[model samples]
Target: MKQMLAWQDISRQGAHQGIARMHKAHRDLLDTIELAGRVRSEHPQISCRDIHYAARGQMPRGRDWTEQLLLSCGFRVKTPPRSFTVAGQGVCANLIEGMSITGANQLWQTDITYVWAGRRWYYVSFVVDVYTRRILASHCSRDLSSASQIRCLSGALSRVAGQDLSGLIVHTDRGIQYTSGEYKRYLESHGLRHSMARYAWQNAYCERVNRTIKEGYLQHYTTDSYSSLAAGVCRAVRLYNHSKPHRGLPCRLSPDQFVKELNQGLHPDYRVNIWSKLTSTKMLYVN
Candidate 1:
């Protein structure tokens, strides 16, 4: 009878310890969930992988675990809206087709996207370097005038004021704003070559940027007014150029980091061959 009593006490103690461990585990899971929520709140449009990377030190879990945690917490990615392209007349040839973009300023892509703010629509023009994947300049306006494109190009040119831009190619779609005489003259004056894409896919680099900025950051922002929208775009550009990690870039670095490393001669052999179906042989390489 004494031996039976001792066994019962030992089992009770073991059960209590098991219950304590379960409670502790529950507390730890709650803490991780809270941390993930905080990270999601900060970067509302980033992917689960990005959030997992962001919460590296705070959550000691792997990528798959973090993804599952986010999914369980109802933190899902929103589907992007459908985009359409307009056909227009262009005067220049596609100079970047099958070209290898090995350095910055060798090729730059520009595009304009529409943003609905307040009771009306606003336009945003962006000039992005194909090599670095950096948005060099952006202009937000109430109208889709050629002046906006000119201003955006001016801003980008100002960044490389002392550099020689003789053979630099500025590619864009067949939009009227781009083919306008004013915009063409501006490019000529700066000694920049003009390249036009017949289809939206041809300008994939800038098109991707347009979608990323609009859907990834701007859509998540509270832009009730034009001023608010502009500010939001500015903040989004800053974050994208500085904070966001690009998978295409070396080491999954941000645009600024990749440019910095490139300037420091870290990635000497890295090259990005522009994907072109126009060429007889497809040459799409990124290393």
Candidate 2:
């Protein structure tokens, strides 16, 4: 009986010592976990990999370790909702497919998304520069009209006024606002080529911008009123352009930072060919 009591005491001491070591290890991780939490709070929809990249200066652990730590700390990562696209007739050809995109202003993509605010739905039109993945302009309205689209496009054009836009191609899905006579006339007057996607996937870049704005930034802001929604949209655009790190960009620089570096000749211009399965299949058959 004495020997049994001694064994039980030893087992209890071992368990306590193991728990103490675990507690100390967790205590040491408090600062890193807090920093990660702050990053996640600021960008609610950011992935764990991005969080680690953003906070790499302060984090001592690697990417996989950071992700595991976040999970163990009870940080629930939310997956974005799935999107579906439908085929449609297009008024213009897909000019960007398989085309080599080398720099900004060469190709711009636009799209519209609905945002719920003030107990109603508000439509927002966004124009993004494909090469830099930067949102150049956006306009919010109560209805999906060509007027809003024109205003949005006008804003984008005004930003680069006096620059040569004759070679610029504006891509969009086959939506009524983009196909309207007024919109087409505006594009012609501005000397911008009209490129329409027959399938929604053809305009993948702009579609991603829509999701980033709606899911990453706007969803976390107050939008109970029209004014709030407009303000939120503005704030989201600024954050996305100035701070959000783009994985596609060199060094994962933000859009604004990439533009700055490019202007300074710090980075070389690279060609990005538009991806299309049909184009690949056709090439294979020809070969």
Candidate 3:
């Protein structure tokens, strides 16, 4: 109740858009509690700070309130994780920038990567909505099976339910899962186009994102149980969606914000693929 009052007080001083953003932030904060609980149960060994950092994704305000709340709940909230894998050698073998965007949702990229869960190896598959830099779906499993890929893909599709995905171009590397007949039929059934990145650079955007998750997000903590990794990934997804700022979007807007603005009839300042032209002195070029 006190937290709600404080939130309302802060929100009252802002513009309508600012108030809306605050409301959204408050809602997201509340939602993170449930997400954090599920994550902590699955990955029981993750620290409260680690989970909180993953939930907020940036410098947190009103953190004392959170700490007190957790302490009241019998959870000890401590300092943030000191994982510096992002700067360590051999942690990431990919560069962070440089990718082409034809249009929004035009190119969806998929990939698989390996992570260490205890002494065993776990594989994770991710499907990213390339335009907004949002990870639509991800799943980690002991083995890379067509069923796993199907599950991830289905989750991604379900997130966009009731929407027209026609003309969507799905881009992926030449993985067997991507080239498999079942995957091909699924794409065809949805009237979605397909493309493959024959070279590693073609998929660099998703690669960088994956590296960020493994290094900045996942590798920062010591998890006593492998299930913690799954929880970490889920928490990471929520942060990635609602909190983390991407360089691609101005105002540090999240992927969810970009989508919301689009749905609310806000137009982008820069063009994605829409071309403009001025006619020449004597002629105009025609396609």
Candidate 4:
């Protein structure tokens, strides 16, 4: 017998005239997920996973059912895949795995993944602060271009314009935008160094951020346009940066909280740093 708990309880009742094959258990969960999302928006520190565990009384194994239901509703879900093919032929060092990141913006990683908006897929590029696990910048576009990449870089630079970026490193998998002449010039002009993962596995951190947003956040909401998805991305990043605690960090503090402590000259506090704002984005496509 497949013990879904409710079924087991029903059988234990001993007197059931008839049973409906489908129950509204999953349907009823929508309300819980919505409540969780609302709390996440306002509080940002309340973990959605914890909400699910409390709602379902146990963690459900497999994809988030809410996400699965949304996907079933006609959204083209995109997952970051292993890129076995070679990237733009370029020489760059690997900065994440073996390197020690002491603070925010010392090392930043960027990656572009697709998000479904309205009817078509839009490219979403994110620049993450490696030390704090904070999303410093994100932008979406109809086409994969250096412009999007530049915008992400620009956002990061704008935040730290007067500070020395000589020690900072921007890492990414070798892609056209990354390897393009213009992109290289921009990095050189800004005095920012470039780093590349030798293999797909080397890009794990950035990819994890991509998965976190697409699977953990995007899947929970139904977005119809690039603007909607972008706004959703903002909401999701805000929650993650302000709430989610990283195991690697000291005190298990959220990125924002950690960063705030560090910037106050609290040495050995093992904190993080920075505040970020997403740029306005609007674009739509239909399949």
What do the candidate models score in CA lDDT, each in turn?
A: 0.84, 0.83, 0.64, 0.68
Q: For candidate 4, lDDT tens digit of each residue in 1-287?
A: 43764675756343233333133455445554565555445443334333443234333332276445434543333444433435877657765554655666788888888877888889888888777777888887888888789998898788667876777888888888888888888898887888887566567667778877777678777679878888888888887787665555665566787778778776464533321122215332345
lDDT of 1: 0.84
TM-scores for the candidates: 0.83, 0.84, 0.58, 0.65
Q: List, residue by residue over 203-230, the lDDT tens digit for candidate 3.
A: 7667766765675567655644568878
Ordering by lDDT: 1, 2, 4, 3
Candidate 2 structure quality by residue, lDDT tens digits, 8-117:
77666667798898987786478668878888766778777777777767876677888788778877567567565443343888898888888889999999998999
Cα deviation at 92, candidate 3, in Å, is: 28
| Cα TM-score of candidate 3 | 0.58
lDDT of 1 by residue, 11-115 (tens): 666677988999977876787788777765655677777776656667756678877877777878886666886756656898887898778889999999999
Instruction: For each candidate in turn, give its C-alpha RMSD to the true structure in angstroms.
Output: 4.7, 5.3, 13.9, 12.0
Once fitted onto the true fold, the runs of candidate 3 whose alpha carbons sit more than 4 angstroms away are: 1-103, 224-226, 271-287
**For model 1, which pairs clash?**
none
Q: Residue 115 CA error for candidate 1 (Å)?
A: 0.8
Worst 10 residues of 3 by lDDT: 84-93
Candidate 2 residue 32 Cα shift, in angstroms, is: 2.3
